[model samples]
Target: MVEVRPLPSADSPLVEAVDLAKHFDVSPPWLTRVLERQPRTLLKAVDGVSFAVPRGRTFSLVGESGCGKSTVARLAVGLYTPTAGRLVFDGTDLAGLNSRAAMAPVRRRLQMIFQDPFASLNPRWRVRDIVAEPIRAHGLLSETRAIDRRVGELLELVRLTAADGQKYPHEFSGGQRQRISIARALASNPEFLVCDEPTSALDVSVQAQILNLMKDLQRELGLTYLFISHDLAVVYHISDYVGVMYLGRLVEWGEARSLFRKPQHPYTRMLLDAIPDLEMTGRRRIPVRGEVPSPMNPPSGCHFYPRCPFANERCRAEVPLSITLPHGGEVRCHAVEEGRLTEAAVRQALGRGASAP
Candidate 1:
């Protein structure tokens, strides 16, 4: 029988991941590989990542495309299992719950809000049925009338009217369709929501509206979020904690304000520098150089060494372990660990003494 652990205290994190790794074996067939004298290939999507989501707070994973932020989202909601390490939700270990029946209880408390609302929702189904599917599946409501009532409530919660439930998903705008998607995800009354680039598909104005709606919902329902995005501006607006990812590994993570104000890792600084300085602060921006390396055959030692300006012999020969920062959070970088890339040095390099926004 699957173990039913005791519930976590209020202080405990809602979700925790320890040394999580997911490797995809993207190898050719055995005969083909043998003929080609090639070794098996493994795509290390999420390599040794660790983070925790506090109850009723937002933790965002920000990175370039193919950096495994979405993979982490999938891992959290059990869409994909990890090849190594553990995923703990509340007090229960997800790795131990192998069977669907065993996972049912935990599944109800956590849900995923996928990207591209246009594709996520069924076109043939009306908005009411789309929103009601989770409620019925989870046995939250039995009677048709009760399900309909609950569906209306959910739609209303996401700023849609009850009358709109009768309309099809094709009838709504992109933002409106996303709102319906949110309503459906909430139908299960989940405590934790894994939002994988939920606003990436919408316009800037619409993204703000959706983000505000999500924030309001979180406040009203005490929900915890695992938000995934490539947009730093979006992350800044929504996240309490921020984790910066690269080549399937977290380079730095900490309180959002602190990390944004003073990014420790060179990769993190590079990403932040890419954002346009709307305020025209004249802080010299570091131009991003080179494309992301292939994950299949990652560089030795530090994956970022090839592109990093401060990389030394040590950086090319040995992987940097995560170092705890004085303010808060952790960074995996030889430069930061060895004091070669201090905040003052970074500021000086930028040709400005003022703090980073």
Candidate 2:
């Protein structure tokens, strides 16, 4: 059996996602369904996912597209109503806020930095107005003059020219727009920020700058982040902890260093393989063989069994329970739990340079 440590109680986590889920009923209206001969369908975007972020830490979600990573980001920020689970922010259950009026306090304390800064920001609005919108919405600053001054301070904080806020979103580069997005998120002085692929669209060099800016801001403000991205390279760079999600469930999660060094799941191994190996002189990255399985008809037992090379009859029929490993974490793999697959095979598959998370 896996030995589970209560994260918040143990290391004092700043953000806890406890059995969080979001299911969507995608069925059409009954009358339309009858006319079109359609059946009611449900989409499980996020299913019983849980993880915690210690104070001043970066917890990232990395997975393929449509793997519920972005959905979790949305659910975390209350952009979508949860059909089954609840969100606990700082020990308070979010469901207790029954009314939008009651949710105001929580709203001001939480913010989101969205992907695609070009699309996220209003092209019509000047950058000053763009950053100041949050300040005005949350009543963070009383005077209009103070709001612009605050926006200027935020611009400087993000390492952007304060005068740049005078222009529109199109006036800046992809990276600069993203910085503006970060500044806007910081305007409300949120304790927690849900960053949804905040750098996926930018150039590799610019990505580093944005990442460094985020890290600096986190250190200065003591912010907690639910960082979302499909890129493992970026995740490895910025995250203190990493969570791997597939088809709506977290197959593996642990400290960033440990997970990269010793990924316990076959799927996790595949993800690691996707990143370019800088260590090997003439390295050839073995691309993940197959496309992601359809979420509407996910495979049974281990959802990754179809693509996993080590999978056997038992793996196809029975779900593996999480097993606590001596290396400082738990792994959800039948072969690992049953001791059917030895550590050597895992090491060979992952490669020689795999280090501890």
Best-performing candidate as measured by lDDT: 1
lDDT of all the models against the reference?
Answer: 0.91, 0.83
TM-score top scorer: 1
Q: Distance from true position, residue 110, model 1, in Å? A: 0.7
Q: Residues 1-357, candidate 1, lDDT per residue (tens digit)?
A: 123433434467889999999999999999999999989999999999999898888999999988999999999998889999889998898888999999998999899898899999999999999999988888877999988888899999999999999999999999999999999999988889999999999999999999999999988888899999999999999999999999999999999999999888999988988898889887566777898998888899999999887889999999899999999799999998888986677766655656564
Model 1 is weakest, by summed lDDT over 10 consecutive residues, at 1-10
Q: TM-score for all predictions?
A: 0.94, 0.90
Model 2: how far residue 345 lies from native, Å: 3.9
For candidate 2, lDDT tens digit of each residue in 134-186? 88887777897888788889999999988998899998999999999999998
- The C-alpha stretches of model 2 lying farther than 4 A from their native spots are 1-10, 35-38, 344-357
What C-alpha RMSD separates each model from the true structure?
3.5, 5.7
